[model samples]
Target chain A: MIEVREDWCKGCNLCIERCPIDALEESDVLNRRGIRPPRLKKENECNYCRLCELICPDLAITVISDDPDEEEKKPVKKTLLTPVGGKIK
Target chain B: MVEIKTADELNKKFLREGMWPTIFCNGCGHGVVLEYTFWALEELGLDMDKVIFASGIGCSSRLPGYINADGLHTTHGRAIAFATGIKAADPDFHIIVFTGDGDCAGIGGNHFIHAARRNIDMTVIMINNFIYGMTGGQLAPTAPLGSVATTAPYGNIEHPFDICDLACALGANYVARWGVSHPYQPIKSIKEGLQKKGFSLLEFLAPCPTAYGRRNKLGDIKKHWAWYDDNTILIEDYEKIMTYGSEEEKEQVKDKIQLGVFQDIQKPGFFESYEKLVDRLKEKEAKTKEGKK
Candidate 1:
């Protein structure tokens, strides 16, 4: 699972536009007085394509998953938390 | 890393606050002009107090506002006029103008030609990014024929002005062309021009990544660099030409315009002659007054 630092996000939508899996849908809930946070509604169907992080202007979001479906792609060394020092632990 | 300094970081006396331009894209050509100007000034090592930076409207003109030196960011095409005034006001000061194709050739055409004709004692750095990178990349006086600009969607049919040839013919004492690709040459040229006595012009061919690069299919700054290597022919190494102007020099050059030092002749600068005329006037006034008394 990926955590979004809502306080830092300016809602640039660079991540929302580049997400290929369509797992991230923007939530209506506004944070810090009122900017909508990009909510992870379809986290179960994530592929962990890190294009969102590369395109984000504010460095707000990151995608993570344990199964790592995109293994054949570049070995993305993202610091995603895993279960008690388990795979990424 | 001594983090690359932004325009705001430069707190020199010449550049003014709230005037540093935020126009150029990341890794744009304007940076090269700024860096070169700084390098030239560092080489001159003049008293910082006696230096004036004049500029017209364009991305390049914004350079005058970035440095920590005395600056005058005048109206478009008026950099030369503004610089001329500064030079005339204080002949000891080193006056430099940083301008663009549109600012110098488009709006400031009359000032450009006349200043050169008068052989004004100043140094001009014309950053020719083909089209006007600012104000949305419109076609300019120096845009090469067939090159695509915002206004010239299809292609530019009009001929471009070769600044070196034009300035040389207009009585400018020194004129040279060097692109950002060969930044060192322009840097050296600027240093030399600052030391020289008469009007000197250095035309720098820079890449406009946002406007010209995108529209002309240049895609990235690297692609524009490649374009320079492929399209430009360096006039040095005189033997590289097919036909030289003369039979003897033809055997030497074959046929080509040499790049280094196109022209460096002893032309009388306006300031020197004007000062002499003033002295004559004062002398005549003294004689007349004495005779009347």
Candidate 2:
């Protein structure tokens, strides 16, 4: 699963363009900035390739998974753990 | 293994704390380029304090301010000249310049050419957005022929500049061009540019969605990226086409943006040549003194 920080999203649609599987779509609702942010359309199809994360200019998207093996692959560093209104894990 | 971190982690490590929210428009590729630069610097383990970032007036010029380093936001189109002075005075200081197409190729064309000709030790990152994005979408030197801008509403009739070709011809030690769609190549190119000894020019074909895109009917960021993906030709392929293909085939691929290291030669830099001249003069002076004695 991934989290889209609605506040930071500028509705660039780059994530939509680069997603290999059609797992993301533009939301009808606009964020505070009045730009429609993309949302995960098919959650199960997401392989966490992180193409969207790499291409996001605003750094608004974060790919999060509960798999411990995948977490071990990531660097051990202090990461920003919360979205807009969510609690830090 | 230097662990691979997320973009957010990298941002926290390198970006200025208070400067959250960049001024670049949504979907603008400037931020992506900046991110790649920061990543390159980080991977290289360069000390921020020892580096001097200089930029001229443009949307891309604002990049230095966000990097948390000693930066000179100089006058319009004079960043290269200012950086030249900085590099000449303190040859050890790692100098990096951020300039846009209009600022570097248009207003400061002479400086751009001369700097490359001199083969000074510095890395220049030119963001070619195809328009004067900050000053409201005026026609830029890098704008493609028949592209629409605010000044060229009907369509631009003027030809665009191939900056990489110009730099390569002028004897720059390193030269490369990459679009924003290919993230890995740009970062790799930038890293190579930073490591190079003499003049290095990295031209990034960025998108100005608000200014150039809206007017050209390519407002959608995805479409703009797709255009870049479709139009760009790899440098190796370009060379193959030029070498073996017929005149007709060459003409067919003429319009595609050739992307890769156009030049990388081991030539003595300006400063090194100057030092050699000084050493020769000193030796001659010593010889003259001995003769007089």
Candidate 3:
């Protein structure tokens, strides 16, 4: 499930531009900020990549998996690794 | 195993609930950087109680105030100095300094240099918006050549400081630069910076659409976001072009800023040396006392 907190969106449109599959689109209705926040236009087209969630500057978008069992799982803690250089491959 | 928490969960856990809808202007990159920090902190699973944030005066400095952790909103150009003191008092505490180009590279240039020189254990997340965003778009030290600003109405004639280059030269343990639009790299860099034992500098080329873009004719939010991807080149690509390419190809990337990890080396941090010095002096004092007895 995807949630777009209308009040929080500043209408950067970064999510719309960054959406890999064009799952999001500009909304016709304006939010409290007088800005047209992106809405989930093609929900089936969305792959749940969460790139929109990560790229949104306003922190307005959130993507949660539909499986209730997955939601119940506790946050996994990973050990820190020694600092290494280079770009992600 | 990876954490699958949503953005809402991370926000509720890390951000000050009252500070929602931050005072940032439309299309501001500061909030994006803050989100990256939250993601990095989450992935590392750091004890927030042991993490103390410090900031100098600027728009980016406002970041610490928004976070739910403890922090010091220090005077202009002194966040690194204050962070040094905090490090000296309690070496175990994780220090994260949030600063802007004007605050870190301009007003606090000396502090930044010395901190890196000493290899102080801290992560400096510098938001370089070219202009001083909060102060009516004044020309910052990091502003590129020919950029327009209130102070430089004609055009900026000054050559901008490549902060990552400066940090790498100063022997920082970790150094990387990324534009805010690139989501994952900044988060990974921030995480690496946190894990580093010595001074780490992460410079984010944030878009100041309101202050910088308006004056520079990049006011359109969409265009401004796209510009970062077009203007910057990966370090690997830059090197490949430089080493094995035609003159035309070389000239194409000559003006493009190189973005990637500039430096990462395992050097003993200042505290590690200080601890050794203290132990050595204590041993000498004990020997002298024994001889006297």
Worst 10 residues of 1 chain A by lDDT: A80-89
DockQ score of candidate 2?
0.18
Leading candidate by DockQ: 3
Candidate 1, residues B33-142, lDDT tens digits: the string is 66666656665666677878899988898786666778898888999998998888889988888999998888898899999999889998888888888788899988
Per-candidate local distance difference test: 0.69, 0.83, 0.88
When 2 and 3 are scored with DockQ, the better candidate is: 3
| B283 Cα displacement, candidate 2 (Å) | 3.2
User: Among these predicted structures, which one has the highest lDDT?
Assistant: 3
The residue-by-residue lDDT of candidate 2 on B1-293, one tens digit each, is 35445666666667785776778898899888887898788888887788999999999999998888899999999999999999989999999999999999999999999999999999999999999999988999888999988788899988888888899899999998888766677888899999988999999988888898888888487677666766777878778888998888788677777777789898889999999999999999999999999
CAPRI-wise, candidate 1 is incorrect
CAPRI band for model 2: incorrect
TM-score-superior candidate, 1 or 2: 2
Model 1 B-chain TM? 0.85
Which of the predicted structures, 1 or 2, would earn the higher lDDT when compared with the native?
2
Fnat of candidate 2, please?
A: 0.29
The DockQ scores of all candidates, in the order shown, are 0.02, 0.18, 0.32
Report the CA-based lDDT of candidate 3 relative to the real structure. Answer: 0.88
